[model samples]
Target: MIALAMVDNFPSSPGIYLMKSAEGSILYIGKARNLKKRVRQYVLGSGDSRLHIRFMVQLVESVEYIVTDTEKEALILENTLIKQHHPKYNINLRDDKTYFSLRMDMKEPYPRLTLVRKVPSDGARYFGPYASATSAKEVLKQLYKVFPLRHYPLATCMARKRPCLYYQIKQCSAPCCGKITAAEYATLAEGAALFLEGKNTEIARIYRAKMNLASQDMRYEDAARYRDLLRAIEVTVERQKMVARGGDSDVFGLYRQGDQVQMAVLHVRGGALTGSRTFLFDWEMETEEGLASFLNEYYDMDTPIPPQILTPLPIPEPAALEELLSEKSGRKVTIAVPQRGPKLEMVKLAEKNAQTAAEERLAKESSSATLLSELADKLHLPAPPRRIECYDISNIQGEMAVGSRVVFIEGKADKSLYRRYRIKGVLQSDDFAMMREVLSRRFRAESDEEKPDLIVVDGGLGQLSVLNAVLEELEVEGVEAAGLAKSRTFRDMESPEISKSDERVFRPGRKNAISLRQNSAPLLLLARIRDEAHRFAVTYHKAVRSKVMVTSELEGVPGIAGKRKKALLVHFGSLKAVKEATVEQLSAAPGMTAKAAKALWEHLHEKQQA
Candidate 1:
């Protein structure tokens, strides 16, 4: 405990303390009302008796503390330190994967508004880390209705010989087709930005003013359009009913017991509930500890930090959290524990939402457990399979062959843990060889760890044999592996509709296969597993095939590499034209080179003749 030795004779001061593991990985970072008392707790092992602490204790090779003037100062320092270090025990909000946001590129001559997962520092106004793709799309849809923003890219708009369908439908201003001036479009775009930023009332008022002017000038059609825009904007805001009673803030509440935790967040943008999101943290942790940990962990990640954060209970280091958040946000941050009023109401609402989410989650988990147990019964396994691994190989006649490994822990997909492997040892068109290679790599990795309960292969007995050989080579014992082979085919008849019983299961080391009765519990389970594997494999295979097709086309273009190829495809709908373009047309394409175009033209022409 280098930190302990340093603190043993040190004077009391409020600051941040970071505990590091033996390898110098941060276990946890914290602040205290009294540094001496807090430091002593760790030295003597007297902090909260939570699972996190126990786990932290195992990793803590040393302790460290920074002294500050007051607890508040310590709070601020702690937030900063925690964000920088991201101690393992903290509940990290920043760890959430980035969701798409609606961005309006404000600096462009004609701002291009679109959905983006990450907000770039290109002078664009971004409006979300929206809960879902659908919600973000809904917002964009509503915004377009209120403002004449073009959804299509500038290139597409410019390339169009005349006004497209969107222009006729009144969905776009069609500046690309010279339907609107730069200055006029700019005014409409600014209003759209304001609307997205939760200034709907002001935007509506501006539209109303424009409508009145148009009416007084006797421009009836223009007045009618502005009137409609104002009404649409108001209607959109009205649909978000909860926004009427709150301020711009976030409400957080947690429902946790043991390692199972559900944290729900309701985002109030411009005083309305824009959306709610629920997060499940499955790692073993204490309830209060997890809440605090999640807060620290989440906010500390490199995500956009909001100004106000409202929680049901006060965080362990509220002051520190606020300061740290303020620094990251580049504005003052308020971490409030509301006792009454809208804040309290918001927390209650959030807690209710959390409770509902938790219940729904528990129900799903229970259902999944039931399904797994039934599946085990159907498969005649010793017990319910805790870890079921599904394998799928994807490729078109063996080109760009890849295999995907999807793991289901108690029925639901653990996507973060899902893996993809490029078939390393096998050349093109060798499915069995590719399967063997993928399984060899996979089992070799798992050979040292506990074997999976079941290995599900998405093919016939040949696929099963590949897995069996890999397991035998690795000497991975006791794990049951099976293949869900395709259903029987009748020569003069159509392919038999594969029912649960139709799925033949080839057990490891067994030459004969058994078909479970369609109604049997085990049959249902096997069918589910087989279908899941098939779905995963097919989706992954299609993705690989698509990528290969795209790359093959780009390969013909002389100057095209990875990035430039992506830019070209993103700009154009297809690579066919890119393969068969004139030099002038190809040069006009985004990220296309004269040499690239000529090379592609020659290649396509040569191939066509050959």
Candidate 2:
């Protein structure tokens, strides 16, 4: 450990300090206004009494610091370093995927609503970074019901001689079949954009005005359509709950039990509760520090920022945070801790939700622990396995073979530890060799991944034997291994109801496969894990297979490298579209030239005619 005297010589200015383990892995990162005083607190043994901090301190072998111009800079730098190194004690984000958003390209001949994960500057209108996928999909579903915009791309549907099912369902006006004029479709697209922006009231007002005008002109059919649209908008708006007086805001509530914290964020847009998000993680720092750090990291995600952010506790340098978020959002932003009134009630509501979420999580974990105990008993294991891994192999005639590994911690999937390996040394359809290769590579001495407490092979006796042999050859010890086999179909002539037997688990050295209760919790959990491994393997296998099949139709075209081929597929949506596109249209694919497009056009035509 570094001497306390070393902290004495450290700079007192605002900066971040990184605590490193003996192996040079950053164990924790912290920011402070006065660096020396903060490090001194840890080194002198008196700054905080949190349990994780004590554990972190025990592992600290050295310290390093970088001075910044101000506390705000220190905060930003601390977030950057923590994200890059993923320190052991930091409250990390649970998901790296950006929230879903709706994109509408007004420039298109017919604009269709599409869900996208990232927000890019493409001159099209974008709405929402919806944290809940269901909420986003529901929004689109409701939008399609109200506004009859095209459901598919213009090029894909324009050739249809008759309107599709969506047109019959009233979800599309069928611009492709000329059921709606270009002018009418433009109005629908504009209305859809406004509705996505949470402007239902505005939509109602405009539709009402149009309804009156249509009636006055004696256009009874048009008036009825406008009346129906207005009614739908009113119903939609009335269903939404108004949580604030005005303006967009995000309110945060937190529940903390020791180092574990569950935080809830309520998204209020246009004065109504639009959606919410919850986060569960461990934090070893003071509540204020954790909240501050979370705010920094959370806002840095491509999530949309609102004008105001309400928190349960005051964050350090609210102005700095506001400035950072404002610069990113291109708006004036404010942060506050409400003391009274409706805003305070909103915070309380968030807290109550957070409490409920935390309680539910605790109960679930408790149930999972019990199930694990039962599972251990079923397997004759010494203790309940805390880290379980299941592996499966996938291939079609040994073509583009792949292996998948899925991990479960405390009966929950830990996606970060999941892996998929491409089979390199195996040939032909030898499942045993595939299993052996996968298990050996997974347990190699240099792998940084943690070894599993239990290894489940997704097959019967042969797979179990392969797993055991690999463990023995690698000299790996203390891991439990089992093979899961599917239920066998049983044809009972007298009893048609008894169609299948229970799924069987094969154990090492056991002649008969043990059958757990078919619908029991332990068996269901195992089935879920096994299914995930199979799905992962199948997905990777398809990707490898597609890469092998993607070579056709474009192989002989000049300037059609891998990236260009992918661009063609993406730009045209499919190879069929690419085949049908004219030379000029083909040239429109990113980075494609007139000469290359012509070559591709002639090549496809020559093949098609031949």
Candidate 3:
């Protein structure tokens, strides 16, 4: 009744709406062309049969809205709110890996191309949001082969006295040592830019002209270089199928089953299929709304937008979306639902890819679910543990001790929740003490709502007892705990007996260790979790140890104090580099005077000699 009253007051204009729970937490966020009409559908339950909508409607206690002059503004506002609040009922897309882009600021005196995740709006030409960092790096490698632009850091190049290996290998123009003039470097940069832009014919023409001029001047070496460049360009064009058949565009295909959705985007550049990106979302919404929300969020201002976008389903408010995209891309943009021809074919291809990816993902998820069920049964857990936290400690003779906590949700690692701790309370190599300290600190930091269903420690009954004591002291209830340890075999001293490997699980209140069957799913899952925790702890321990060693090594030098050590490390990059540096280089480093540099150099060399 209250929801209907709130809907009655909604304005009949395009805007964003927020559905809140009793405690005012946002349950869902949505955008609409007509706020009043949209809100009424949810409040009255008029023809909206989606399972999630029915569920969300039951939780929505109050409603709020922000009126906008246009649907595009509402769309933008909805995306921002969804990200900020992470509404429980919205289709949330969490992509941890950001694609890489090749960025180069042409305004710089000696422009160098570099890979970056974010594209700054500082007049730099950005080439890609490549499918992966490796793909972007491969493109950079190819560019280096054809264009000898500077590849080293600008500061390093400026400070260097001679050309490095890249220059010697003809992969760099060596602007640091003046091997190439500014004008010549600019020409190379332009050629590289054109090549990335898929203007291969223009680049080939320029290379051919350069080859002719070099031959006419009787510079056979230069002519041969240009010939090779032309050949590389020709091969790349043929391989990419860049035949000037189609303009730049992006095709989006969507697949949905129950609450699971998958989206695939195909990027076409210069009539050639360049790359594709796949995204998965787990939520329910109308197809048009889902597609609209995705389109608005995926193509942010910083992301490169193609001139034309093809969608499997027609998006709501095409004109408004087109206008917003045009403003973002700085050109006219079109959003179309193709019915026939090559554009339709591209859409079909994207849909096919999406469907295949969805199937694989579902199969993997089903296997994970089965494994979780099996594990719960083996452990005699009250329910299948959705989130399991594993703890491990790593140290070498009680020095540089560290502990790691790894989280797994439904048999998949949730890396965002993983944590590391320095074993400050325990100075000695006591696994029991280390486990207690780590668990106490971890539970103290996390709220009850964030607690894991199960806690796994790496050890035998001793470690399990420590963890159980800590949990009891903290009064943390409703959580199960266990420890994993390698089984030991006993043999008679006077008689020989066959031996076998045994894996054991130690649980609280159990008089004897639980023996798991060999190659069982539950045993394997627990072993994998324990190994991952150990690996994380060891990695963190090594990093901490390295820092300690570097600090200690620098402190041995008479005049190198903490500040000087930091400055030296920051400038020279490492302790080994500082040790290998000459007196002049050391003096040039920040915070180091000539006298101090000489003294430090002598002290390091003396220590090495001794």
Candidate 4:
């Protein structure tokens, strides 16, 4: 346990503190204006009523602290450390998908717009972190219709003898072939950048003047092109409803159900609702502190920080957070909890989104729980198995043998707990031995508490026997085992005598398999788990096979060393892409000389011809 003496010894200054468990893992991280006072409250068991904190305090073996010049600095450090360590007792944002932004370095001679996940500090203009790649691409498509900026890479464009299809379709200016001068292409690139930045009025003005000048010069085609560009910009602006009513700001709303917390952020850029993001976490901290911490972490340098931030809950130390944001953004920033009017309405809308998201999550969890309960009853289990692990083996002719273990928690796949193993001890296509080896290795490494309540193998009686044998040898107790096997032929509904045993579930010591009801929830759940394990194993096996193929193919080419092969793969994304690349593109790749590129190209095509 953390000693009171250590708490007393903490410095009386603004800083962050880390509560570490006996196993040396960080349990919680917090920032305080006075480190000594904050640590004392937890050590003395006073003013810390949070249930999670009480549990964390019992496990804390030591308290570590770092002093900072100000509370703002301490907040920054706290966010960084929390993200780095991901302490158990703290709320951490974990999202499966990251939004993307459109990026272009305007300084480039013929700038090409591209999609990027992060907004870097390099001198380049960034458009957004659009909710999906499709949305970002849609915007790019619209911009291309108007801007006609260069679309090819610098090397490809410079090396090409003729313009590609994009140029023929007037989607690019073809700066590489000198169809458009560098200065003219730069002007077009700037217009595209301006449109992405939501400066539609300015771009429209430029286009209008160009159109009128072209018309006066008797260039009807040029005038028509400029008119179409101006029209596209105006239509896009109207569709997005871009206006400068409330300036740029972000509104945050939070909802909580027990320990579950959901936050919704609505991004209002130039007074238009651009996009929103939702974050879900399990936290036990006070609402104000949680909101403050989330804001500190969410608005890092890479994320565009607006002038105003509206939160439904009043943040603790709002002034300090505002100061920190202002310092980071190089502008005045306001953190407000609006009580009434339009701003308040925005907060309420955000809150509604958070509540809806939470409800959907709870509904899904409830359904999963119901399915798990049904499955448990059908399997004659004492209770619903919270964790079910299913295993499968995949290989072709004993080559690249691999096994997969997929996990399901309350009937929902818990992919994080899934594991894979290469069949190291077994040779040839013996599924029984492969299953035995995999189970032995897995059970030996897992602790008693981490053991699954039920284990499933992706085969019938043979696989079940292997699983039971391994469990018995390991002396593992209180865990049930079963095997699932697919039926050979499709069921004939026309004949009543036809058995609808699409899936057969086998239990140890049971000579006959249990035929699951056709289209039953329990059967479907088992099928999903078994299929996931099979898919994982097959994917790994294929990856191993592909790597071997790539190695063999690369080895056949003389003078191509491992480093050069790696460079080629990294540049082209795969061996298939490398094979498809032209000699010019191959030569342009890093670590490739002209002669080597030609030789590699010839060798790849030669194999294809053979």
Q: List the residue pairs that clash in candidate 2.
A: none
TM-score of each: 0.82, 0.88, 0.84, 0.81
Clashing pairs in 3: none
For candidate 3, write residues 53-75 as lDDT tens digits. 78878887888899999987987
Instruction: Compose the digit string of candidate 4's lDDT tens values, residues 396-458.
Output: 988889999999987888888888898999888898998899898888845554889999898
lDDT leader:
2
**Span of ten consecutive residues with least summed lDDT in model 4:** 91-100
Q: Candidate 2 lDDT, tens digit per residue, 370-411?
A: 999999999898899999999999998987899999999999
Ranking by lDDT: 2, 3, 4, 1
Off by over 4 Å in 3: 2-10, 21-23, 37-62, 94-96, 141-151, 158-184, 236-238, 241-244, 378-382, 486-521, 549-610
Clash statistics: count for each candidate: 20, 0, 0, 0
Candidate 2 local accuracy as lDDT? 0.86
Which residues of candidate 1, in runs, are more than 4 Å off?
1-7, 18-27, 41-62, 66-95, 120-122, 243-246, 258-261, 282-292, 427-430, 445-450, 487-501, 509-525, 554-610
Model 4 segments more than 4 A misplaced: 1-12, 17-28, 35-65, 80-88, 94-98, 131-192, 233-244, 300-304, 326-333, 422-427, 446-449, 487-501, 572-588, 605-610
- Candidate 2: count the clashes: 0
